[model samples]
Target: MALSPEDVIKKSFSATHLRRGYDETQVDDFLDEVVVELRRLVSENDGLRTDLEDCRASRGVASGQGAAAPAAQGERHEDAEDTQELEALRRQLAECQEARAAAERRAEEAQERVGAAERERDEARSSLEAASAGAAVGASAAGGDGEDPSSIISLAQRLHDQHVAEGESTRARLIEEGDTYRTTVVAEADERSAELQRTGQETHDRLVAEGQATHDELVQTGQSRHDELVQTGQSRHDELVSTGEQTRDRLVAEGQASHDQMISEAEQQRSTVLEDLHGQESALSATIGGLQSQERDLRERLRAFLSDQMERLDGSRPTS
Candidate 1:
Protein backbone atom coordinates (compact mmCIF):
# COMPACT_ATOMS: atom_id res chain seq x y z
CA MET A 1 0.00 0.00 0.00
CA ALA A 2 0.99 3.56 -0.60
CA LEU A 3 2.35 5.51 2.34
CA SER A 4 0.37 8.53 3.48
CA PRO A 5 2.02 11.92 4.03
CA GLU A 6 1.67 11.40 7.74
CA ASP A 7 3.15 7.94 7.46
CA VAL A 8 6.01 9.19 5.33
CA ILE A 9 6.64 12.03 7.77
CA LYS A 10 6.57 9.73 10.75
CA LYS A 11 8.97 7.36 9.08
CA SER A 12 11.34 10.14 8.20
CA PHE A 13 11.31 11.44 11.75
CA SER A 14 12.01 8.03 13.16
CA ALA A 15 14.93 7.56 10.79
CA THR A 16 16.23 11.02 11.50
CA HIS A 17 16.07 10.45 15.22
CA LEU A 18 18.05 7.26 14.91
CA ARG A 19 20.73 9.03 12.89
CA ARG A 20 20.78 12.25 14.89
CA GLY A 21 19.48 13.85 18.06
CA TYR A 22 15.81 14.68 18.64
CA ASP A 23 14.53 18.27 18.35
CA GLU A 24 10.78 18.63 18.61
CA THR A 25 10.31 21.81 16.58
CA GLN A 26 12.79 20.72 13.94
CA VAL A 27 11.06 17.39 13.67
CA ASP A 28 7.73 19.11 13.27
CA ASP A 29 9.05 21.25 10.43
CA PHE A 30 10.66 18.25 8.81
CA LEU A 31 7.41 16.39 9.03
CA ASP A 32 5.68 19.23 7.22
CA GLU A 33 8.27 19.06 4.47
CA VAL A 34 7.89 15.31 4.24
CA VAL A 35 4.14 15.66 3.80
CA VAL A 36 4.68 18.08 0.94
CA GLU A 37 7.26 15.88 -0.75
CA LEU A 38 5.25 12.72 -0.27
CA ARG A 39 2.19 14.28 -1.87
CA ARG A 40 4.30 15.38 -4.82
CA LEU A 41 5.88 11.98 -5.16
CA VAL A 42 2.50 10.30 -5.20
CA SER A 43 1.22 12.55 -7.94
CA GLU A 44 4.27 11.99 -10.10
CA ASN A 45 4.12 8.28 -9.54
CA ASP A 46 0.53 8.21 -10.77
CA GLY A 47 1.43 10.03 -13.95
CA LEU A 48 4.38 7.78 -14.58
CA ARG A 49 2.26 4.70 -14.08
CA THR A 50 -0.20 5.89 -16.72
CA ASP A 51 2.59 6.58 -19.23
CA LEU A 52 4.16 3.22 -18.58
CA GLU A 53 0.88 1.46 -19.24
CA ASP A 54 0.52 3.23 -22.56
CA CYS A 55 4.09 2.28 -23.53
CA ARG A 56 3.47 -1.35 -22.64
CA ALA A 57 0.33 -1.51 -24.77
CA SER A 58 2.23 -0.13 -27.72
CA ARG A 59 5.04 -2.59 -27.17
CA GLY A 60 2.58 -5.46 -27.16
CA VAL A 61 1.43 -4.61 -30.68
CA ALA A 62 5.02 -4.43 -31.92
CA SER A 63 5.81 -7.76 -30.28
CA GLY A 64 2.90 -9.39 -32.11
CA GLN A 65 4.28 -8.24 -35.48
CA GLY A 66 7.77 -9.39 -34.54
CA ALA A 67 6.40 -12.86 -33.76
CA ALA A 68 4.65 -13.19 -37.12
CA ALA A 69 7.83 -12.65 -39.16
CA PRO A 70 9.34 -15.77 -40.80
CA ALA A 71 12.16 -17.53 -38.89
CA ALA A 72 15.37 -16.88 -40.86
CA GLN A 73 18.99 -17.89 -40.12
CA GLY A 74 19.84 -17.33 -36.38
CA GLU A 75 16.29 -15.95 -35.95
CA ARG A 76 15.63 -18.67 -33.35
CA HIS A 77 18.61 -17.40 -31.39
CA GLU A 78 17.19 -13.89 -31.56
CA ASP A 79 13.92 -15.19 -30.19
CA ALA A 80 15.63 -16.13 -26.90
CA GLU A 81 16.94 -12.60 -26.56
CA ASP A 82 13.45 -11.32 -27.33
CA THR A 83 12.07 -13.56 -24.61
CA GLN A 84 14.54 -12.12 -22.14
CA GLU A 85 13.50 -8.62 -23.08
CA LEU A 86 9.87 -9.56 -22.69
CA GLU A 87 10.57 -10.95 -19.23
CA ALA A 88 12.37 -7.77 -18.28
CA LEU A 89 9.45 -5.73 -19.52
CA ARG A 90 7.11 -7.86 -17.44
CA ARG A 91 9.19 -7.21 -14.39
CA GLN A 92 9.10 -3.50 -15.07
CA LEU A 93 5.33 -3.68 -15.54
CA ALA A 94 4.98 -5.45 -12.18
CA GLU A 95 7.05 -2.77 -10.49
CA CYS A 96 4.89 -0.09 -12.08
CA GLN A 97 1.78 -1.83 -10.85
CA GLU A 98 3.12 -1.93 -7.32
CA ALA A 99 4.06 1.72 -7.45
CA ARG A 100 0.64 2.63 -8.85
CA ALA A 101 -1.03 0.78 -5.98
CA ALA A 102 1.11 2.61 -3.47
CA ALA A 103 0.31 5.94 -5.09
CA GLU A 104 -3.42 5.19 -5.06
CA ARG A 105 -3.28 4.37 -1.34
CA ARG A 106 -1.41 7.57 -0.62
CA ALA A 107 -3.97 9.54 -2.60
CA GLU A 108 -6.78 8.03 -0.54
CA GLU A 109 -5.03 9.03 2.64
CA ALA A 110 -4.50 12.52 1.34
CA GLN A 111 -8.22 12.76 0.58
CA GLU A 112 -8.96 11.70 4.15
CA ARG A 113 -6.67 14.40 5.46
CA VAL A 114 -8.43 16.96 3.29
CA GLY A 115 -11.81 15.79 4.59
CA ALA A 116 -10.55 16.16 8.15
CA ALA A 117 -9.30 19.63 7.42
CA GLU A 118 -12.70 20.54 5.98
CA ARG A 119 -14.39 19.25 9.12
CA GLU A 120 -12.06 21.28 11.27
CA ARG A 121 -12.78 24.36 9.23
CA ASP A 122 -16.50 23.75 9.66
CA GLU A 123 -16.01 23.43 13.41
CA ALA A 124 -14.05 26.65 13.47
CA ARG A 125 -16.87 28.38 11.61
CA SER A 126 -19.36 27.09 14.17
CA SER A 127 -17.20 28.34 16.98
CA LEU A 128 -16.96 31.74 15.33
CA GLU A 129 -20.77 31.87 14.97
CA ALA A 130 -21.20 31.00 18.66
CA ALA A 131 -18.70 33.63 19.71
CA SER A 132 -20.44 36.24 17.56
CA ALA A 133 -23.83 35.31 18.99
CA GLY A 134 -22.47 35.56 22.53
CA ALA A 135 -20.97 38.96 21.78
CA ALA A 136 -24.28 40.14 20.33
CA VAL A 137 -26.13 39.00 23.43
CA GLY A 138 -23.61 40.77 25.68
CA ALA A 139 -23.91 43.97 23.69
CA SER A 140 -27.73 43.85 23.83
CA ALA A 141 -27.66 43.39 27.60
CA ALA A 142 -25.18 46.23 28.05
CA GLY A 143 -27.24 48.54 25.81
CA GLY A 144 -30.45 47.79 27.78
CA ASP A 145 -28.99 49.99 30.51
CA GLY A 146 -28.59 53.33 28.71
CA GLU A 147 -26.23 54.59 31.43
CA ASP A 148 -23.21 52.72 29.88
CA PRO A 149 -23.27 53.63 26.22
CA SER A 150 -19.49 53.84 26.27
CA SER A 151 -19.20 50.30 27.69
CA ILE A 152 -21.58 48.93 25.04
CA ILE A 153 -19.59 50.59 22.27
CA SER A 154 -16.37 49.23 23.74
CA LEU A 155 -17.79 45.70 23.70
CA ALA A 156 -18.79 46.06 20.06
CA GLN A 157 -15.31 47.32 19.21
CA ARG A 158 -13.74 44.37 20.98
CA LEU A 159 -15.95 41.95 19.04
CA HIS A 160 -14.89 43.54 15.76
CA ASP A 161 -11.25 43.36 16.75
CA GLN A 162 -11.52 39.68 17.64
CA HIS A 163 -13.21 38.90 14.32
CA VAL A 164 -10.50 40.74 12.39
CA ALA A 165 -7.79 38.85 14.25
CA GLU A 166 -9.41 35.50 13.56
CA GLY A 167 -9.85 36.34 9.88
CA GLU A 168 -6.18 37.34 9.61
CA SER A 169 -5.07 34.12 11.25
CA THR A 170 -7.18 32.02 8.87
CA ARG A 171 -5.86 33.90 5.84
CA ALA A 172 -2.27 33.38 6.97
CA ARG A 173 -2.80 29.66 7.34
CA LEU A 174 -4.35 29.42 3.85
CA ILE A 175 -1.41 31.32 2.37
CA GLU A 176 1.10 29.01 3.98
CA GLU A 177 -0.76 25.93 2.74
CA GLY A 178 -0.95 27.32 -0.79
CA ASP A 179 2.78 27.99 -0.84
CA THR A 180 3.58 24.51 0.35
CA TYR A 181 1.26 22.95 -2.22
CA ARG A 182 2.80 24.91 -5.09
CA THR A 183 6.33 24.01 -4.06
CA THR A 184 5.42 20.37 -3.78
CA VAL A 185 3.84 20.30 -7.24
CA VAL A 186 6.92 21.82 -8.83
CA ALA A 187 9.22 19.37 -7.15
CA GLU A 188 7.06 16.47 -8.22
CA ALA A 189 7.09 17.57 -11.85
CA ASP A 190 10.87 17.80 -11.85
CA GLU A 191 11.20 14.34 -10.35
CA ARG A 192 8.82 12.86 -12.93
CA SER A 193 10.77 14.46 -15.78
CA ALA A 194 14.03 13.00 -14.50
CA GLU A 195 12.44 9.56 -14.19
CA LEU A 196 11.00 9.67 -17.72
CA GLN A 197 14.36 10.69 -19.13
CA ARG A 198 16.08 7.82 -17.37
CA THR A 199 13.49 5.31 -18.56
CA GLY A 200 13.70 6.58 -22.13
CA GLN A 201 17.47 6.31 -22.13
CA GLU A 202 17.33 2.73 -20.90
CA THR A 203 14.75 1.78 -23.53
CA HIS A 204 16.84 3.41 -26.25
CA ASP A 205 19.92 1.46 -25.19
CA ARG A 206 18.06 -1.85 -25.23
CA LEU A 207 16.61 -1.19 -28.68
CA VAL A 208 20.04 -0.20 -30.05
CA ALA A 209 21.59 -3.37 -28.66
CA GLU A 210 18.85 -5.52 -30.19
CA GLY A 211 19.27 -3.84 -33.57
CA GLN A 212 23.02 -4.38 -33.53
CA ALA A 213 22.62 -8.07 -32.71
CA THR A 214 20.12 -8.56 -35.53
CA HIS A 215 22.35 -6.68 -38.00
CA ASP A 216 25.36 -8.84 -37.15
CA GLU A 217 23.42 -12.07 -37.55
CA LEU A 218 21.99 -10.85 -40.87
CA VAL A 219 25.52 -9.97 -42.14
CA GLN A 220 26.48 -13.65 -41.87
CA THR A 221 23.24 -14.91 -43.45
CA GLY A 222 22.45 -12.48 -46.39
CA GLN A 223 20.28 -9.51 -47.37
CA SER A 224 16.79 -11.05 -47.12
CA ARG A 225 16.16 -11.44 -43.37
CA HIS A 226 18.58 -8.69 -42.48
CA ASP A 227 16.75 -6.13 -44.61
CA GLU A 228 13.40 -7.37 -43.30
CA LEU A 229 14.39 -7.14 -39.61
CA VAL A 230 15.95 -3.71 -40.08
CA GLN A 231 12.90 -2.40 -41.91
CA THR A 232 10.49 -3.83 -39.32
CA GLY A 233 12.45 -2.57 -36.33
CA GLN A 234 12.85 0.90 -37.83
CA SER A 235 9.16 1.10 -38.71
CA ARG A 236 8.07 -0.04 -35.26
CA HIS A 237 10.49 2.35 -33.53
CA ASP A 238 9.28 5.28 -35.59
CA GLU A 239 5.66 4.38 -34.97
CA LEU A 240 6.18 4.10 -31.22
CA VAL A 241 8.05 7.38 -31.01
CA SER A 242 5.51 9.24 -33.11
CA THR A 243 2.54 7.84 -31.23
CA GLY A 244 4.12 8.52 -27.84
CA GLU A 245 4.92 12.10 -28.80
CA GLN A 246 1.40 12.69 -30.06
CA THR A 247 -0.07 11.19 -26.90
CA ARG A 248 2.13 13.39 -24.75
CA ASP A 249 1.20 16.47 -26.74
CA ARG A 250 -2.49 15.66 -26.48
CA LEU A 251 -2.23 15.17 -22.75
CA VAL A 252 -0.48 18.50 -22.39
CA ALA A 253 -3.17 20.24 -24.38
CA GLU A 254 -5.89 18.62 -22.32
CA GLY A 255 -4.18 19.68 -19.14
CA GLN A 256 -3.95 23.25 -20.36
CA ALA A 257 -7.61 23.22 -21.28
CA SER A 258 -8.54 21.90 -17.89
CA HIS A 259 -6.46 24.58 -16.23
CA ASP A 260 -8.14 27.26 -18.26
CA GLN A 261 -11.52 25.86 -17.36
CA MET A 262 -10.64 25.95 -13.69
CA ILE A 263 -9.44 29.53 -13.97
CA SER A 264 -12.63 30.55 -15.66
CA GLU A 265 -14.72 28.84 -13.03
CA ALA A 266 -12.78 30.55 -10.28
CA GLU A 267 -13.20 33.95 -11.90
CA GLN A 268 -16.92 33.36 -12.22
CA GLN A 269 -17.16 32.39 -8.57
CA ARG A 270 -15.21 35.45 -7.51
CA SER A 271 -17.44 37.72 -9.53
CA THR A 272 -20.53 36.13 -8.00
CA VAL A 273 -19.16 36.52 -4.51
CA LEU A 274 -18.32 40.19 -5.13
CA GLU A 275 -21.79 40.84 -6.48
CA ASP A 276 -23.37 39.18 -3.48
CA LEU A 277 -21.20 41.21 -1.13
CA HIS A 278 -22.21 44.42 -2.87
CA GLY A 279 -25.86 43.52 -2.62
CA GLN A 280 -25.45 42.72 1.06
CA GLU A 281 -23.78 46.07 1.68
CA SER A 282 -26.59 47.90 -0.05
CA ALA A 283 -29.23 46.03 1.93
CA LEU A 284 -27.43 46.66 5.21
CA SER A 285 -27.13 50.38 4.47
CA ALA A 286 -30.82 50.62 3.68
CA THR A 287 -31.72 48.74 6.85
CA ILE A 288 -29.51 51.01 8.96
CA GLY A 289 -31.06 54.14 7.44
CA GLY A 290 -34.55 52.84 8.08
CA LEU A 291 -33.70 52.02 11.70
CA GLN A 292 -32.20 55.51 12.23
CA SER A 293 -35.32 57.17 10.81
CA GLN A 294 -37.52 55.13 13.15
CA GLU A 295 -35.31 56.05 16.12
CA ARG A 296 -35.60 59.76 15.23
CA ASP A 297 -39.41 59.51 15.06
CA LEU A 298 -39.48 57.75 18.41
CA ARG A 299 -37.31 60.47 20.00
CA GLU A 300 -39.58 63.22 18.63
CA ARG A 301 -42.61 61.51 20.05
CA LEU A 302 -40.92 61.22 23.46
CA ARG A 303 -40.07 64.94 23.40
CA ALA A 304 -43.71 65.83 22.63
CA PHE A 305 -44.95 63.64 25.51
CA LEU A 306 -42.47 65.17 28.00
CA SER A 307 -43.36 68.73 26.86
CA ASP A 308 -47.07 68.11 27.35
CA GLN A 309 -46.46 66.69 30.90
CA MET A 310 -44.28 69.74 31.80
CA GLU A 311 -47.10 72.08 30.61
CA ARG A 312 -49.63 70.27 32.82
CA LEU A 313 -47.26 70.45 35.84
CA ASP A 314 -46.72 74.18 35.20
CA GLY A 315 -50.49 74.75 35.11
CA SER A 316 -50.88 72.79 38.42
CA ARG A 317 -48.34 75.17 40.15
CA PRO A 318 -50.62 78.23 40.22
CA THR A 319 -49.01 81.78 40.11
CA SER A 320 -45.52 80.33 39.75
Candidate 2:
Protein backbone atom coordinates (compact mmCIF):
# COMPACT_ATOMS: atom_id res chain seq x y z
CA MET A 1 0.00 0.00 0.00
CA ALA A 2 1.09 3.55 -0.61
CA LEU A 3 2.21 5.28 2.56
CA SER A 4 0.86 8.61 3.81
CA PRO A 5 3.08 10.87 5.87
CA GLU A 6 1.35 9.52 8.99
CA ASP A 7 2.02 5.90 7.92
CA VAL A 8 5.64 6.72 7.24
CA ILE A 9 5.90 8.16 10.70
CA LYS A 10 4.40 4.98 12.24
CA LYS A 11 6.25 2.40 10.14
CA SER A 12 8.94 0.03 11.55
CA PHE A 13 11.76 -1.41 9.54
CA SER A 14 13.54 -4.78 9.85
CA ALA A 15 17.10 -4.52 11.08
CA THR A 16 20.01 -5.31 8.76
CA HIS A 17 21.70 -8.70 9.40
CA LEU A 18 25.18 -7.13 9.47
CA ARG A 19 24.31 -4.68 12.25
CA ARG A 20 25.38 -1.89 9.93
CA GLY A 21 22.11 0.01 9.70
CA TYR A 22 21.69 3.48 11.14
CA ASP A 23 20.18 3.90 14.62
CA GLU A 24 16.46 3.20 14.36
CA THR A 25 15.19 5.57 17.06
CA GLN A 26 17.15 8.51 15.67
CA VAL A 27 16.12 7.67 12.16
CA ASP A 28 12.49 7.36 13.11
CA ASP A 29 12.48 10.65 14.95
CA PHE A 30 14.15 12.40 12.04
CA LEU A 31 11.78 10.90 9.49
CA ASP A 32 8.76 11.76 11.60
CA GLU A 33 9.92 15.35 11.95
CA VAL A 34 10.51 15.52 8.24
CA VAL A 35 7.06 14.12 7.58
CA VAL A 36 5.45 16.67 9.83
CA GLU A 37 7.24 19.52 8.11
CA LEU A 38 6.47 18.05 4.71
CA ARG A 39 2.77 17.81 5.54
CA ARG A 40 2.78 21.38 6.77
CA LEU A 41 4.42 22.57 3.57
CA VAL A 42 1.98 20.58 1.48
CA SER A 43 -0.94 22.13 3.33
CA GLU A 44 0.48 25.61 2.83
CA ASN A 45 1.19 24.95 -0.83
CA ASP A 46 -2.35 23.70 -1.37
CA GLY A 47 -3.74 26.78 0.33
CA LEU A 48 -1.71 29.13 -1.88
CA ARG A 49 -2.66 27.20 -5.01
CA THR A 50 -6.33 27.29 -4.07
CA ASP A 51 -6.06 31.01 -3.37
CA LEU A 52 -4.67 31.67 -6.85
CA GLU A 53 -7.34 29.56 -8.50
CA ASP A 54 -10.09 31.24 -6.55
CA CYS A 55 -8.73 34.65 -7.37
CA ARG A 56 -8.79 33.83 -11.04
CA ALA A 57 -12.30 32.43 -10.72
CA SER A 58 -13.50 35.53 -8.90
CA ARG A 59 -12.46 37.95 -11.61
CA GLY A 60 -15.91 37.76 -13.14
CA VAL A 61 -17.53 38.21 -9.74
CA ALA A 62 -16.41 41.77 -9.24
CA SER A 63 -19.87 43.28 -9.27
CA GLY A 64 -22.35 40.47 -8.69
CA GLN A 65 -22.60 39.69 -4.97
CA GLY A 66 -24.20 42.26 -2.68
CA ALA A 67 -21.09 43.06 -0.67
CA ALA A 68 -19.13 42.68 -3.86
CA ALA A 69 -20.99 45.66 -5.26
CA PRO A 70 -19.37 47.97 -2.75
CA ALA A 71 -16.03 46.37 -3.45
CA ALA A 72 -16.70 46.76 -7.13
CA GLN A 73 -17.72 50.37 -6.60
CA GLY A 74 -14.55 50.96 -4.69
CA GLU A 75 -12.62 49.36 -7.50
CA ARG A 76 -14.45 51.43 -10.05
CA HIS A 77 -13.72 54.54 -8.06
CA GLU A 78 -10.09 53.62 -7.99
CA ASP A 79 -10.20 53.02 -11.71
CA ALA A 80 -11.83 56.36 -12.20
CA GLU A 81 -9.14 57.98 -10.17
CA ASP A 82 -6.54 56.18 -12.19
CA THR A 83 -8.14 57.31 -15.42
CA GLN A 84 -8.31 60.86 -14.20
CA GLU A 85 -4.71 60.73 -13.10
CA LEU A 86 -3.72 59.33 -16.48
CA GLU A 87 -5.64 62.01 -18.30
CA ALA A 88 -4.05 64.62 -16.10
CA LEU A 89 -0.67 63.09 -16.73
CA ARG A 90 -1.31 63.12 -20.45
CA ARG A 91 -2.23 66.77 -20.24
CA GLN A 92 0.92 67.43 -18.26
CA LEU A 93 3.01 65.58 -20.81
CA ALA A 94 1.40 67.51 -23.61
CA GLU A 95 2.12 70.70 -21.75
CA CYS A 96 5.69 69.63 -21.22
CA GLN A 97 6.00 68.80 -24.89
CA GLU A 98 4.54 72.14 -25.72
CA ALA A 99 7.02 73.76 -23.38
CA ARG A 100 9.85 71.89 -25.04
CA ALA A 101 8.61 73.01 -28.43
CA ALA A 102 8.34 76.54 -27.17
CA ALA A 103 11.85 76.35 -25.78
CA GLU A 104 13.08 75.02 -29.09
CA ARG A 105 11.33 77.83 -30.89
CA ARG A 106 12.87 80.34 -28.50
CA ALA A 107 16.32 78.82 -29.04
CA GLU A 108 15.86 79.13 -32.79
CA GLU A 109 14.64 82.66 -32.31
CA ALA A 110 17.62 83.37 -30.03
CA GLN A 111 19.96 82.21 -32.78
CA GLU A 112 18.16 84.45 -35.22
CA ARG A 113 18.38 87.29 -32.79
CA VAL A 114 22.07 86.62 -32.26
CA GLY A 115 22.63 86.56 -35.98
CA ALA A 116 20.71 89.79 -36.42
CA ALA A 117 22.66 91.36 -33.55
CA GLU A 118 25.93 90.28 -35.14
CA ARG A 119 24.79 91.81 -38.41
CA GLU A 120 23.84 95.02 -36.61
CA ARG A 121 27.21 95.14 -34.86
CA ASP A 122 28.97 94.53 -38.16
CA GLU A 123 26.93 97.27 -39.78
CA ALA A 124 27.74 99.62 -36.92
CA ARG A 125 31.45 98.85 -37.23
CA SER A 126 31.27 99.35 -40.97
CA SER A 127 29.48 102.70 -40.52
CA LEU A 128 32.09 103.72 -37.92
CA GLU A 129 34.92 102.77 -40.24
CA ALA A 130 33.30 104.74 -43.07
CA ALA A 131 32.87 107.76 -40.78
CA SER A 132 36.47 107.40 -39.60
CA ALA A 133 37.66 107.41 -43.20
CA GLY A 134 35.61 110.51 -43.86
CA ALA A 135 37.02 112.16 -40.72
CA ALA A 136 40.55 111.26 -41.78
CA VAL A 137 39.94 112.83 -45.15
CA GLY A 138 38.62 116.02 -43.45
CA ALA A 139 41.63 116.04 -41.06
CA SER A 140 44.08 115.66 -43.98
CA ALA A 141 42.36 118.47 -45.88
CA ALA A 142 42.49 120.74 -42.79
CA GLY A 143 46.19 119.95 -42.13
CA GLY A 144 47.05 120.64 -45.76
CA ASP A 145 45.69 124.31 -45.57
CA GLY A 146 49.29 125.44 -44.60
CA GLU A 147 47.87 127.93 -41.96
CA ASP A 148 49.39 126.93 -38.52
CA PRO A 149 49.83 123.46 -40.01
CA SER A 150 51.04 121.89 -36.74
CA SER A 151 47.92 123.15 -34.74
CA ILE A 152 45.55 122.03 -37.52
CA ILE A 153 47.20 118.60 -37.55
CA SER A 154 46.91 118.29 -33.74
CA LEU A 155 43.20 119.33 -33.76
CA ALA A 156 42.53 116.83 -36.54
CA GLN A 157 44.31 114.10 -34.57
CA ARG A 158 42.18 114.82 -31.46
CA LEU A 159 38.94 114.69 -33.49
CA HIS A 160 40.01 111.35 -35.01
CA ASP A 161 40.76 109.96 -31.52
CA GLN A 162 37.26 110.97 -30.29
CA HIS A 163 35.59 109.28 -33.24
CA VAL A 164 37.58 106.08 -32.63
CA ALA A 165 36.56 106.00 -28.94
CA GLU A 166 32.87 106.50 -29.80
CA GLY A 167 32.94 103.65 -32.31
CA GLU A 168 34.55 101.28 -29.80
CA SER A 169 31.97 102.17 -27.12
CA THR A 170 29.02 101.53 -29.46
CA ARG A 171 30.45 98.13 -30.52
CA ALA A 172 30.94 97.07 -26.91
CA ARG A 173 27.33 97.94 -26.00
CA LEU A 174 25.92 95.95 -28.97
CA ILE A 175 27.97 92.87 -28.02
CA GLU A 176 26.85 93.04 -24.40
CA GLU A 177 23.14 93.22 -25.32
CA GLY A 178 23.39 90.07 -27.53
CA ASP A 179 25.21 88.15 -24.75
CA THR A 180 22.53 89.07 -22.22
CA TYR A 181 19.65 87.99 -24.48
CA ARG A 182 21.30 84.64 -25.25
CA THR A 183 21.91 83.96 -21.56
CA THR A 184 18.28 84.70 -20.66
CA VAL A 185 16.93 82.36 -23.37
CA VAL A 186 19.23 79.53 -22.30
CA ALA A 187 18.24 79.87 -18.68
CA GLU A 188 14.51 79.67 -19.53
CA ALA A 189 15.02 76.48 -21.55
CA ASP A 190 16.90 74.82 -18.69
CA GLU A 191 14.12 75.66 -16.23
CA ARG A 192 11.44 74.21 -18.52
CA SER A 193 13.36 70.94 -18.88
CA ALA A 194 13.76 70.67 -15.13
CA GLU A 195 10.03 71.18 -14.58
CA LEU A 196 9.18 68.40 -17.06
CA GLN A 197 11.55 66.03 -15.30
CA ARG A 198 10.04 66.76 -11.91
CA THR A 199 6.50 66.19 -13.14
CA GLY A 200 7.47 62.90 -14.79
CA GLN A 201 9.06 61.61 -11.59
CA GLU A 202 5.99 62.49 -9.52
CA THR A 203 3.70 60.70 -11.94
CA HIS A 204 5.89 57.59 -11.83
CA ASP A 205 5.83 57.51 -8.04
CA ARG A 206 2.04 57.88 -7.87
CA LEU A 207 1.53 55.05 -10.36
CA VAL A 208 3.85 52.75 -8.44
CA ALA A 209 2.08 53.40 -5.17
CA GLU A 210 -1.34 52.82 -6.72
CA GLY A 211 -0.23 49.54 -8.27
CA GLN A 212 1.21 48.28 -4.97
CA ALA A 213 -1.97 49.10 -3.07
CA THR A 214 -4.13 47.30 -5.60
CA HIS A 215 -1.91 44.25 -5.42
CA ASP A 216 -2.14 44.12 -1.65
CA GLU A 217 -5.91 44.38 -1.72
CA LEU A 218 -6.23 41.59 -4.27
CA VAL A 219 -3.96 39.31 -2.23
CA GLN A 220 -5.90 39.94 0.95
CA THR A 221 -9.27 39.28 -0.68
CA GLY A 222 -8.06 36.13 -2.34
CA GLN A 223 -6.67 34.79 0.91
CA SER A 224 -9.95 35.39 2.69
CA ARG A 225 -11.91 33.59 -0.03
CA HIS A 226 -9.47 30.71 -0.08
CA ASP A 227 -9.81 30.14 3.64
CA GLU A 228 -13.58 30.08 3.31
CA LEU A 229 -13.52 27.52 0.50
CA VAL A 230 -11.13 25.26 2.40
CA GLN A 231 -13.30 25.29 5.48
CA THR A 232 -16.43 24.51 3.49
CA GLY A 233 -14.72 21.64 1.72
CA GLN A 234 -13.53 20.22 5.03
CA SER A 235 -16.97 20.46 6.61
CA ARG A 236 -18.61 18.66 3.67
CA HIS A 237 -15.98 15.95 3.83
CA ASP A 238 -16.54 15.41 7.52
CA GLU A 239 -20.31 15.26 7.05
CA LEU A 240 -20.02 12.61 4.37
CA VAL A 241 -17.69 10.53 6.52
CA SER A 242 -20.03 10.73 9.48
CA THR A 243 -23.01 9.70 7.31
CA GLY A 244 -21.09 6.70 6.03
CA GLU A 245 -20.12 5.67 9.52
CA GLN A 246 -23.73 5.86 10.71
CA THR A 247 -24.97 3.76 7.80
CA ARG A 248 -22.32 1.12 8.49
CA ASP A 249 -23.17 1.00 12.16
CA ARG A 250 -26.91 0.59 11.48
CA LEU A 251 -26.24 -2.23 9.03
CA VAL A 252 -24.07 -4.06 11.58
CA ALA A 253 -26.74 -3.72 14.25
CA GLU A 254 -29.46 -5.04 11.95
CA GLY A 255 -27.29 -7.98 11.01
CA GLN A 256 -26.84 -8.84 14.68
CA ALA A 257 -30.60 -8.64 15.27
CA SER A 258 -31.25 -10.99 12.29
CA HIS A 259 -28.67 -13.46 13.62
CA ASP A 260 -30.39 -13.54 16.98
CA GLN A 261 -33.80 -13.98 15.33
CA MET A 262 -32.49 -16.92 13.28
CA ILE A 263 -31.20 -18.56 16.40
CA SER A 264 -34.47 -18.25 18.38
CA GLU A 265 -37.33 -18.39 15.83
CA ALA A 266 -39.18 -21.46 14.41
CA GLU A 267 -38.77 -22.51 10.75
CA GLN A 268 -41.46 -20.24 9.31
CA GLN A 269 -40.25 -17.17 11.23
CA ARG A 270 -36.65 -18.15 10.41
CA SER A 271 -37.48 -17.97 6.71
CA THR A 272 -38.96 -14.50 7.20
CA VAL A 273 -35.88 -13.44 9.15
CA LEU A 274 -33.69 -14.87 6.42
CA GLU A 275 -35.55 -12.79 3.84
CA ASP A 276 -35.13 -9.70 6.01
CA LEU A 277 -31.44 -10.44 6.42
CA HIS A 278 -31.11 -10.84 2.64
CA GLY A 279 -32.84 -7.45 2.20
CA GLN A 280 -30.49 -5.89 4.77
CA GLU A 281 -27.51 -7.42 2.95
CA SER A 282 -28.69 -5.97 -0.33
CA ALA A 283 -29.16 -2.54 1.29
CA LEU A 284 -25.70 -2.74 2.82
CA SER A 285 -24.30 -3.60 -0.58
CA ALA A 286 -26.14 -0.72 -2.15
CA THR A 287 -24.81 1.67 0.48
CA ILE A 288 -21.29 0.38 -0.10
CA GLY A 289 -21.70 0.74 -3.86
CA GLY A 290 -22.92 4.26 -3.48
CA LEU A 291 -19.98 5.13 -1.25
CA GLN A 292 -17.62 3.54 -3.75
CA SER A 293 -19.10 5.59 -6.59
CA GLN A 294 -18.76 8.75 -4.56
CA GLU A 295 -15.18 7.81 -3.68
CA ARG A 296 -14.37 7.24 -7.36
CA ASP A 297 -15.86 10.56 -8.32
CA LEU A 298 -13.86 12.27 -5.59
CA ARG A 299 -10.71 10.53 -6.77
CA GLU A 300 -11.35 11.57 -10.36
CA ARG A 301 -11.85 15.18 -9.36
CA LEU A 302 -8.69 15.08 -7.25
CA ARG A 303 -6.70 13.65 -10.14
CA ALA A 304 -7.92 16.36 -12.48
CA PHE A 305 -7.15 19.08 -9.95
CA LEU A 306 -3.67 17.67 -9.43
CA SER A 307 -3.07 17.46 -13.19
CA ASP A 308 -4.10 21.07 -13.62
CA GLN A 309 -1.88 22.10 -10.71
CA MET A 310 1.10 20.23 -12.13
CA GLU A 311 0.62 21.79 -15.53
CA ARG A 312 0.35 25.25 -14.03
CA LEU A 313 3.50 24.72 -11.98
CA ASP A 314 5.39 23.35 -14.97
CA GLY A 315 4.50 26.28 -17.15
CA SER A 316 5.61 28.73 -14.48
CA ARG A 317 8.89 26.94 -13.72
CA PRO A 318 11.99 28.88 -14.75
CA THR A 319 14.42 27.43 -17.20
CA SER A 320 18.14 27.57 -16.55
> On residues 1-320, what C-alpha lDDT tens digit does candidate 2 reach at each position?
64357777667766532323245587568677758755864685576566557665544222234576676677779778877876776677677667657656765665566566656656665666666666666767777565555554566566656665665666566556656755675576567657756876787787778767867776777667666766776775587568657865975796687667645645556577689999999999999999999999999999999999999999999999
Q: Candidate 1 regions off by >4 Å? A: 1-147, 219-320
Q: What is the lDDT of residue 245 in candidate 1?
A: 79
Q: Report the poorest 10 consecutive residues by lDDT, candidate 2.
A: 15-24
Model 1 weakest 10-residue run by lDDT: 12-21
TM-scores for the candidates: 0.29, 0.37
Expressed as tens digits, the lDDT of each residue in 38-143 for candidate 1 is 6875675565455445443332223434653565435657656766765666566556556555555655555566556656666666676676677667767767
Highest TM-score model number? 2
| Candidate with best lDDT | 2
| Each model's Cα RMSD | 48.5, 27.9
* lDDT to native, each model: 0.63, 0.67
